[model samples]
Target: MTHPGKPLIEVVNLEKDYPAGAGVLQALRGVSLSIAEGEFVAIMGASGSGKSTFMNLLGCLDRPTRGSYHLDGQDVSRLSSDQLAALRNREIGFVFQGFNLLPKLSALDNVALPLMYAGTGREARRRQAQAVLERVGLGERSHHTPLQLSGGQQQRVAIARALVTHPRIIFADEPTGNLDSETSRQVMDFFSQLNREEGITLVLVTHEADIAAYARRRIRFQDGRVVEDVAQAEVAA
Candidate 1:
C-alpha cells in the first residue's frame, strides 16, 4: 500500500473542454499534479469551479481533451475504450452521494455486482461479498435491501461494495452528502481509519470545508484551475 515516493496518479497539462453553442467551454486549464499511493487527498470547489470535471478524469470516468494522464505508470490517455474500462475496473473503486445501489438486490448482491461483471462464480461472489460486508460491520444486514437500511448503513454498504474488489484507489464524490451530521462524522471516521490502518489511497471530492478537513491534503479549485494545494493536519475525532 505505501510506495514511498511512487505516485499512483500523475497528470501533465491536464485540460478538458465542453462544446457550447457556436463555441467551446474550457472546464480545465492545464492543471497538473501528482498523488502518491496511500495518500488521502480532497478536492474542493464551488459550482462551476471544474473540480467535478477534474475528478471525472482522475477517476477514469472521462478522458481529458488535452494533456496526458499516467495511472500506475500506464498512460491511460492512450488506452482504447475497452482497455480503459478494464483498467478502471481493476484499479479503481467508486463511492457516490447517491449510494447507487440496486433496489431489488440484497445488500450482498449489490456489493458483489463488480465481481459478477468480472465473471466470478456465484458461490465465490457471495462469499467475497459477505466477507466485505462483515468488514464494514454489516454482516447481519447482508440479506436486507437498501430500502430497509438507514442512510448511514446504506453508505456503509456502498463502502463495502467499493472495497470488495481490493482496488488500489477509491474515488468518493460527496459520500456524506446524504447523511445526517453525526452519520457524516462516522463515515469520515471510517475513511480515515482505512487510510491510516490499511493504507488505501483515497481521493474525495466535496464542497464543504468540514468534509475536506478529514483529508490529510487539500486541493482547491477556482475557475477551472487549482488555486491551492497544501498539506494540513487532519481533524482528529
Candidate 2:
C-alpha cells in the first residue's frame, strides 16, 4: 500500500541476480514494497537473505536484473548511470557503517565534498557544512580529521556529510554498527529527531533488534523475500 500525498518509494517484483560459475546466483527474488515520505523503516534479515541486495537496488548503487523501482514516483529502473548519480546526489543521503570520510580532509571539507561536485561556491559550501556539523553536535570538531576523532564522533561527521546535501531521504546501512551501547542510543536519537523535525524519510538496515525497535515500521527478509511487514503497534502487541 502507498501513502497519501505521495509515496517516496515504490518497488514491484524487484529481483537481483549475479553471475555464478555457470548459472546465475539469485540475490533478491520478487520483492515488493512501498514507503511514504517521513516514514522511518528498519530492514532486517540474516546474511544472504537479500536485505543488502534490496538496499543496494533502492540506493541505485547496483541495478536489478529484473523488476521496476519507482523512487518519489519516478521510474528509476531505467535511468542512465550519469542520471542515477545525479539523482542520488540531489535526493538521497547515505550513512555507512564504516564512516567513509576522506582521510586527508578536515571534517568541514569532507562534508562539503558533495557540494563541490554540484558547483556550490566556496562560502556557501562552508556555511552549509558548518551548519550541518553544528546540527550533529560536532561544530567544535569541524577542523578535525577522521583519524583525530573518536569512532562515535567520526560517525557524526559522516551523518553531517549526509545531511549537508539537504537530501529528502537517508539510507543508512547499520548506522550504529561500530558504536557502544550509549553511543548507539545517541545516534538513534539523532535519527529520530531528524525524521520527526525535518520530515526526512529514513530507511536503515539494522540487525540489532533494539535498534530496529526505533523504527515505526519493521520489515524482515528471508530467502530474498519479505517475511514480515508490520507497524510498531502491531509488533508490540
Candidate 3:
C-alpha cells in the first residue's frame, strides 16, 4: 500500500546557472515542485527548457545554485558532495537512456555493484541482485554481458540495478530514448508496475508525448520555468 501524506521530494525556489562565454545562462529559474510518495510524475520540455537541469537536481547529481531542496524530509541543499553521494546511494535510484551497464561485466555483477559499494556482503548482494533481476524479468539473462543482450534486455538489467538498493524513489531520464516504440512501452509498463505494486515513487524525464503518457501527472517546462502542471485526465484526451 502507498504511504499516505509522505512528501518524498520538495524543491523550493530552486535555480541553476551556467557560466557562458560572456554571460551567465540561467537553466532553472526558481522552480518549485513537490512530489508525494508513490506518485508517478513526468517532467517534459524541449531541448533548452531546463528539464534536464531539473532531472539533475531531482536525482541528486547536482545541487541547485540557490534555494533549498528537501528529499525525504532531509535538507539536501546544504550537504557536501560526499554526504550527498551517501544520501543518493541510500535514497535515489537512477535509470538513464543508455542503460549505463558495464560492458564487460555480467548483468548480475552490474546489478550487484551498488550493494558492494554500500559494503553489503557478497552473498547477500548476489541474492538481492538476483531478486531484483527477476522482478525486472531478466533473471534468465543475469549471466549475460551488456554486449550479449538485446536493447530491451539491457534496459531491464539496468532497471534491476537501480531497484536492487530498494530506494525511496527512482529517477529515469529519457529511459526509452534508445529503444523502439514497443520496447519503450514494455519498459514503461514495468515502471508503472513498480510504482503501483512496490509503492516506489517514479519521476521520469521525457520529451516524447507517448512516453510521458504513462505517468499520472505531467509538468511542462519552458524557458527555464514550468508553464503547465496537468493531471492525466487533462492531457490524456
Q: Who is ahead in TM-score, 1 or 3?
A: 1
**TM-score, model 2 to reference:** 0.96
Question: Pairs clashing in candidate 1?
Answer: none
How many residue pairs clash (N, CA or C atoms closer than 3 angstroms) in each of the candidate models, in the order given?
Answer: 0, 0, 0
Scored by lDDT, the top model is 1
- When sorted by lDDT, best at the front, the candidate numbers are 1, 2, 3
Clashes of 1: 0
Candidate 3 Cα RMSD (Å): 2.6
Per-candidate TM equals 0.97, 0.96, 0.95
Clashing pairs in 2: none
lDDT of 1 at 96: 92
By TM-score, the best candidate is: 1
Which residue runs does candidate 1 get wrong by more than 4 Å? 1-4
